[model samples]
Target: MSDQHQASASVSAARALPQLGAWVPGYVLRIAYAVTAAIAALLQFPLGSWLYLALLVALVGALRPRTLAPWFFLAMTGLSMLWAPPNTHSAAFFALLALGHLTHVFAARMLAVPARARLQLRSLARPLLHFAVIQATTQLLAVLVAVLLPGSSGASAVPLIGVIAALALLALAFVLITPLLRHERRDERR
Candidate 1:
C-alpha cells in the first residue's frame, strides 16, 4: 500500500467504525459464513476430498467465489450421511469449519479487496448487523424444521447445534465490540 492510501485507510477506519485490535470489519462475518458453508459441504465422505484439494489450490492462488460454490454444493450432496452421524467426530469437524471461515475472511481482505489496505473494520457495522440477523433467523428456522423432521437423530443434530452456537457466540462478541469501543471513547473524553 502507498503511504497516501495507508494514511487515508486509517482515517477512514477511524471515521467509519471502531477498531477491534486490527480494525477487522464486521462484514468479515459474511466471509465467515461463506467459508463455513464451504466447509460444511466438505464434511462429506468422497466429495470432501475434492473440496480439500480445491481449498489448497485457492490458498496458493486467487479464489473466485463463483468457481468454488458449485463444488461446495456437489460435495454437500454427501451430507445425507450426517443425519445419524456420530458425535465422536464433531471436534475435528468444527475445527475445520472455523479454519475455513477464517481463511475466507483473510483471502477477501488480503486478495480480493484492492483497497483493503485502507479499509476499516468500523465501516461495515450496519451491513454486518443486517446480514447477521438474516443469517441467524434462517439458521434458527432450519434448526426448528430439522427438529420437526423425522429420522433426524440427536447425534446428528448435536453437531449442527454446536456449530450454530459457536457462530452465534462469535457474532455476538463482534456485535458487542462496537458499542464497547464507543463507550470507551466516550469515557476517555470525560
Candidate 2:
C-alpha cells in the first residue's frame, strides 16, 4: 500500500479507539453479575447462583447472536427456573444491560464509518471527539443508574477502578472483533 493509504489506516484505527471502548460498558455489568452470583452461591442461594449463568448466555448472545440467541434463551430460562418471580427481575436487567451496550456498539460503528472511508487524518479527528462524547454520556448514565438503583453498592473508588478495568477489556475486545464483523456485514450487503 502507498504511504497515504497506510496513514489513512492508522488514522482510522486511532479514531476508533474511543468507540471501541464502548464495548467495555456491558462487560462491566457481566463481570459484576458474576461477582454477585459468586456472593449468592456462598450465601447458599441456589437460584442466585445461576445468575452468572444467565449473564454468560447474555454475553454469548452479544458476541454472536446468530449462533447464540437460542442458546441464550434456553440458558436464561433454565437459570430463571431456580429463582422466584422477584429474582427473575435480574434476567430483565441483564437483557436490557446487554441491549444498551449493543446500542453503544452500533453508535461506535456509526462514528467510525466516515473515518474508515475518508483517507484524511484530519477528517477522523472530529469523529474521535464524538466517540468520546458518546462514551461520556453513557458513563454518566451508568453512574446515575448505579445511584438510583437500590442495593447497587453505590459508587466508590474501587468501583471506579472496576469500571476502568472493564472498559479496557471491552476496548480490546472491540478493537479485535469489530473490524471482522463489520467487514463481513459489508461484504454480505454488497
TM-scores, each model vs. reference? 0.37, 0.24
lDDT of 1 at 43: 54
Model 2 lDDT per residue over 1-190, tens place: 9999999999998877333321233333333333433333233224454555554544554444345443443434433433332221243433433434443333333333431232333443665576567667755655565556556433233244445767998999999999999999999998
Shift of residue 116 alpha carbon in model 1, Å: 4.9
lDDT of 1: 0.51
Which one wins on TM-score?
1
Off by over 4 Å in 1: 1-48, 57-112, 153-190
What's the lDDT for all of these models?
0.51, 0.46
Q: Please give the distance, in angstroms, between residue 15's alpha carbon in candidate 2 and its true position after superposition.
A: 30
What would the per-residue lDDT of candidate 1 be over residues 1-190, giving only the tens digit for each residue? Answer: 9999999999998889544454554344435544554564455334556566554544332334335543444334324434436433344443443444444444444444442244466655655565467556644554554556456334555557657866999999999898999999999999
- Residue-level lDDT for 61 in candidate 1: 29
lDDT of 1 at 172: 96
